[model samples]
Target: MILAVDVGGTNIRTALIASHGGTVQELRSRVSLGDRGVSENDLIEKLSALFSEIISSHNDISAIGIGFPGFFSAGSGILLSSPNLPQLHNVDLAGRLSEAVSLPVSMQNDALCAAIGEHRFGAGKGHANLLHITLGTGIGGGLILNGVPYTGESGMAMEFGHLRVAGSDLPRSCGCGGSGCVEAYASATAVSAQYFERSGIQTDAGDIYERACKGDKHAKEIIESAGHCLGMAIAQAIKLLDIHTVTISGGFAGAWPLLHPAIIKSLDTELIPPLKGKTTVLRSTLDDTAGLLGAAALIN
Candidate 1:
């Protein structure tokens, strides 16, 4: 059994997993992660308490793995920079968790973890190459190439949200300080903002979708624009990697009904023949457990 923990910006979920021919056990529990006002120490304490409780029941866990949100040094487990959880900077999360739980600890970015989970048991199953994109509080991505998670020079391989897109203002900055990155237009926050800006509607993506379903032209336009932007970014990725199975996860996947058509349309328009219908975009099959399950796979 492996102890899997997914520490998000505002939530912490834990699961006890037993690998059986690549499928995992599903004893799971979750709790609220602190808001911006929460201190680093508070976050650590909350996680430690949860791990301790779980260890009491699942004492035979072979290892502990965590899916952490932020720019982390894979080798050192040091959180260098995290847009959602700035208080985590310089934190030795793996070291702390290992010490607290008395177990070997492993960690990966949430997107990377989610990708591993999808590749192992979700939508990307049986695919040698896979891409996982999380369009949540911010955009994050992961790539599994040849059945391995390919963290680049510094263990940050698929930071796809940071990639610049066409038809965007160069000076437009993303939450990561980059110019016109995918996150600038593809994230849930971006979608809501666009909806509000385009229509006088002060609503979230859900409301926008509802209105669009009712034939609101402005809502439809906003959805299409976001889909186009997301599609263009994915098209560029395809040009470089030629990955066939791409999975979309997180809050933004809610826009799939509106976004996917545009994404497929844009990709088909850009790709050459023979590769036109090759790539298939999928919605994540895993529910909230995806991240934690993927974290557990680090030890599997």
Candidate 2:
């Protein structure tokens, strides 16, 4: 049994996982942190407390795997930066947690972990090369090349969201300080911001999606714009890597009905003839549990 934790900007999800033939049995999902903002110390304490609770009830845990959203040193488990969770920069989070929990900890970028989970047990199963994208408050990506997870020299490869794309007239900037990045227009935050700006309604991406589902033309337009931008970015990635399988997942991807048409349309419009009909863009089957399963896969 493995303890898997997925730490995101909005929540920290932890679960115990048992894998059996490409299927993962999740014991239960516990949210240690909700939408509340917390300091580094507070976050660490929450993690430690959560682990202690799990340990008190279970035994024979092999290792702890953490799927953290940020740039970190793969060797040292030192988080360098997290645009969303800025308070965690330069913190040796794994080291701290290991001392507290008395368990060896392995940390990985959240998106990369998602990709690994998908490749081993979810949407990208049976595919040797594919891209896994998480679309939420921000956009994140991970790549599998020749049946291996491909994190570059510094463990910072497959940063697809930060890649420049055609800029939108809407005033927006990415967390990475770029204006033309795909995330600037395609992320959940971006979509909600665009909607708020246009409609003067303050709501989250999910609410906007609900409005779209009710046939709100303005909401649909906002979502379609985001989808078109995201699809264009995917086209560039396919052209560059020549990888056909792409999996889209995350909290915001639940709006697939609103995004799929525009994405397919843009892909058809942008991809070259040779790439046409060869690519497959899939929705994640693992859902939110992908990160936890992925974190457990790291230990194995």
Top of the candidates by lDDT:
2
Q: Scored by Cα lDDT, where does model 1 land?
A: 0.80
lDDT for model 2, on a 0 to 1 scale?
Answer: 0.84
Residue 249 displacement in candidate 1 (angstroms): 1.4
Model 2 alpha-carbon drift over 4 Å, by segment = 19-43, 85-92, 167-171
TM-score to true structure, per model: 0.88, 0.89
lDDT by residue (1-300, candidate 1, tens digit) is 888888887677777787532455555645787687667778678778888888888768878888887767855666676767766677887888788878888888888999888888888889999988887868888899999888787666788988777875443567776678878877778777877777766787777777888999988887887778778888889989988989998876877888899889988887778678889999998855678778888884
Q: Give the RMSD in angstroms, all C-alphas superposed, for model 2.
A: 2.6
Q: Under the 3 Å rule for N, CA and C atoms, how many clashes does model 2 have?
A: 0
Q: Which 10-residue window in model 2 sums to the lowest lDDT? A: 19-28
Query: What is the Å distance of residue 92 in model 2 from its true position?
Result: 4.1
